[model samples]
Target chain A: MNDLPHGLLTPQILVELDVLERNIERVARTVSAKGLALRPHAKTHKMHEIAGRQLEAGAVGLTVATIGEALTFALHGVGDLFVAYPLWISDAQAKRIRELLSYVKLSLGTDSIAAVQQLARQLADKKDKLGLMIEIDSGHHRSGVLPDEALDVARAAREAGLNVIGIFTFPGHSYAPGKPQEVTDQEQHALGEAARLLRADGFELKRISGGSTPTAELADNSLLTEVRPGVYVFGDAQQFELGRCQWENIALSVASTVISRHEGDAQNPRRIVLDAGSKILGSDRPGWATGFGRILENPDARISAISEHHATVLWPEGQPLPAYGEQLRVIPNHVCVAVNLVDQVSVVRDGEVIEHWDVAARGLNF
Target chain B: MNDLPHGLLTPQILVELDVLERNIERVARTVSAKGLALRPHAKTHKMHEIAGRQLEAGAVGLTVATIGEALTFALHGVGDLFVAYPLWISDAQAKRIRELLSYVKLSLGTDSIAAVQQLARQLADKKDKLGLMIEIDSGHHRSGVLPDEALDVARAAREAGLNVIGIFTFPGHSYAPGKPQEVTDQEQHALGEAARLLRADGFELKRISGGSTPTAELADNSLLTEVRPGVYVFGDAQQFELGRCQWENIALSVASTVISRHEGDAQNPRRIVLDAGSKILGSDRPGWATGFGRILENPDARISAISEHHATVLWPEGQPLPAYGEQLRVIPNHVCVAVNLVDQVSVVRDGEVIEHWDVAARGLNF
Candidate 1:
């Protein structure tokens, strides 16, 4: 552990190479054994190194949330990409998309006719070569058209000369505690119905993409051809609380130094201030997300409160508090946002830093 | 407004150059009128252009939260800087600080005897030349020693051959709704007591720094020799709701395109989704904060829900909803987090793109 970055900086993202590789192997094995294509979402780690590892582990393609993300992976030589977003592309972006298409096979998600038609117009001359998926609204009522309405978008894209690649849905509701099984059932039903409806509409629904790290394992291989999971490679506090992964399975953790130790009062005796705060750990506490995050050194020590540059962890009654300047590994509430907050992450193996990787796709929301 | 970036990616940060100038001028004028030295916090905009403007407007120096942030500004010719947070400096960072001090009049924050002694040892030969400020716990209760305990840390620094330059604090509690006045009063008391204690202890304390955007206006120039305010330069939803500023004062907003819309099923009557999600707008909602943020086009519309890549906003019944692909300006709950999420911001004047300013000090947490 002494090999870990010390006296360098506080609140720096540190990915254990051995653990990260194990996480990638574990997910790839499960995905491959189930005979389903693994399109690991690059939006989690957002590093070319991690994306390359996934590709090496037999991922058919990489999944992204934005054109910028897709562009980053494509530029880094990740050939096949899926922009799993109902994008509102500008003319300039459409041109950029074409530029990306010239280098790799690109797939896009469409939930509305306007988006399908717009994409068709953008892909005009080469529309027939482009891949499109009709995104179906599963239990997660964020985006995507309803299952019954998937055919309208599929047919519209086909009419516009784009290849309609079946349907896809994100069972994001699975994030809540113990809701994975229930949300997975909802996802299976939604995608199954959308594929059936598209087939009945005289369309050959070839591909069905089911996404959501929490619901990925419960995905039926027969109904869902592929599963796109981003956070599985990270395993955050939310995932740990959801029983989706164990603490030992969390591959991503932040190295933070204890900056101040305030023995509050008799009522609250063990409160220590950490350098990791909202700016680094990220302010992503869902009502159910125990605390800001769990202190890996002592899970019972919860980050009771957080400000922009300080995290106050109050240890339950009798546990020993870390001394000022002591380092602690913190598992953030949501690894994705926390990863996005840093410019680069130090890759370590058995306490020794192997190398540093740039969070290439970070802040690439555009 | 038509000349503004259109058909571009959604969830991009847009800064109205005219409004930005007005905000800077407003804060500089306020601080100047009070005869207090203004050292605008660069952690807000984190851009060289804005820092330059503040310096041009008579700002004595720049205040940064991290050594990296200070270094960036210093490399850009920003000579005088202060790292206001209680930093945990490592051996490597101590070396970096020396490099910074070579070009800039740098000041470091210390709240513990250990930190002061460590810093003194690191700067052993020229320890007395290094500027150090004992951070006093005004009312935030995050970091800093109590006013009464400041002497112990001060004597430790002086004994270690270091110069103790007065004290500093952040009235962070003022961030709560309707608590600005009370927090400001607390700050005055804390700083006033610390100064008196230090003077009686036979210490010549000169630089008494104070910070807090919400409480900056209420700061007493007689006690606080310098004031640092960051978020005031770009008002946010929190500020607007706290009556600190008005809607017209919000200089920064996310230009997000309407991605999805749900026409009620009796539950949610007029709900629409924007591409700007937590990854773009940032998740920093205080309990009293109305919503994630407010839509500038429709202030009544509240982003009641948000995911990583989508913000679900519900408008008041019967209010017009933006069409899919239409753009809306969103004022984030906290502008600092939102600005930190993006790499570059679109600078517009008269609704036309003038230049792009890199969030230069972004992700410089270390």
Candidate 2:
């Protein structure tokens, strides 16, 4: 309990180092025991310090969502990198990719035949090896080539003199409650089929990667050589709702204060407004989420509405409510997006301050 | 033109000095011509540099949504400040409030009896001078005391020794297309009824404030003495959809390059992909917005989807599409939120680089 005064946690993200270490250890152990490589996605915790911990915990490498994110990690000495996003390689990006291949091993994802041809043409002069992963559309209809089209894409990449290493898919459908098991099963089946098809076409399928936080536990690592799961290290409202993790297991939270209280009817008070709003706790409410966010200490309270700077929460029944100016902890709907919204996060241990880490990779969306 | 290389706009926000000057002059002229006190909300452009511009444009004071924002502006020498949101006052905040009152004229809003009582008790020593604005629910329905409950809260504040300055409301419903006139009409009616009710109870209603970007143009300044309108300085996708301004009038945009292009199909030969996504351009979609966002220079193109790091766009028919590595400008859906995501914005004029201004108040949401 450092008496650093309240409100010093302005735009702050409090992370319990103990809980974070536990999560990292658990995920790494689970994946390693099952003989699968753990390529923890850097999108969840963008800090190099956290990435170093993951690597120390036996993660084979790190996965990122964009070239910019990969470069951010690489600059901090992260060598083996896999950009999981289906990147559209331009001339400038191709040059950057060639340069990156010189320092570290790079695996890029592609979902289009045109993209595969473009990458091959751009890297014709490069002698360094670059891995290519063909993205398969398992269930999420956002982006990815259909499983039936995987072989054609793989053949095209091979003909273009690019290394067709493996298949990858994001089982984003596993995010919903009670759906993780089924979604994971579907994802495993999709990856297995895609892998077999590539092998039948005389292409070497070196890696088969699939998993999200909700489906990571249920993933069939028997066939997958590597598992990439982000957001599992910092459980959020989404993980809590999916029954993947408990509130106590949550590692990240926004420390906010009750700036105002509205006492309408004693029996059914209207709402308890907090200083933490959409701006602090990102306004990302998945379809099944009960509210914009949840109060860590006050479980029964739900944030009903959020403006740019005000979060209106409805209090629970038969509970002692907080008065104006009281401090509260908030667990956002999506921890990854919420953490990205802030400039810095406080690394806390047993309610005491440890150190402050700047979100160096924040706002690197492009 | 500055002849700067492509992708040289280091900071995201490009604030053209000449265009901003014209926008400020226009808004000030409109307020003066309509006989209303202009208190521009600083939440849109958090930079004190821009706030100073608004003050130089004849703004009576500045309106912020949070105490943190108020403190930030106060540090930058902004004297008169109005925390427009109905805040919850705490002990820690009370001390800050007292310190702020010594330097600037401070006015805060309250929509509930409990909040009013808390604020009154907190300001017991300085209640004689601190101004209080009763937030009236004027069709927005987010947070504000109902028109009927305004007098009760006002009575509580007065009894507790706080000075009741006036009432205020936000006509957020005016953001609809071609509905500004109707929304402002409702706003004026609500202000009139709330003012009359407070006056009947022997409370002096010194100021009646209302107006947002959409309703500002149609606001009837007869009843209200002051207006608070943010987002007028930088036109966004919402303003474009509401027919308030043309695409060319948009002062802010995200500069990105075509990192990938798919020319496989002639019918949709030009599928341009950008590096900017939800993190750069906010994921906010107004009900009437056609797509996630619009492409600058190419109005026919629409941003089809946004993943964490990729922006997929479908190019228009019969147009010369940008090749890979060609830079393009994107006008985001919501300029205010997008600006908050970055640390700095580039100030440009006539395609020439002017300067980079820090978003000093970016994360001051708390």
DockQ of each: 0.66, 0.31
Q: What TM-score does the predicted chain A of each candidate obtain versus native chain A?
A: 0.97, 0.95
Q: How much is the lDDT of residue A254 in candidate 2?
A: 78
Residue clash pairs of candidate 1? A90-B7
B307-365: candidate 1 lDDT, tens digit per residue: 88999898778867778789888889999889989889988777776889999989887
Over B28-141, each residue of candidate 2 has an lDDT whose tens digit, in order, gives 999988999999999898998889999998999999987778988998999999998777676666877887887888899888778888887777878877899989867766
Tens-digit per-residue lDDT, A27-88, candidate 2: 99998888889999988878988999999999989998776678888888889999987776
Count clashes in each candidate, considering only residues at least 3 apart in sequence or on different chains: 1, 6
List the lowest-lDDT window of 10 residues for candidate 2 chain A: A1-10
TM-score of the second chain, each candidate in turn, equals: 0.97, 0.95
Q: What share of the true interface contacts does each candidate keep?
A: 0.72, 0.26
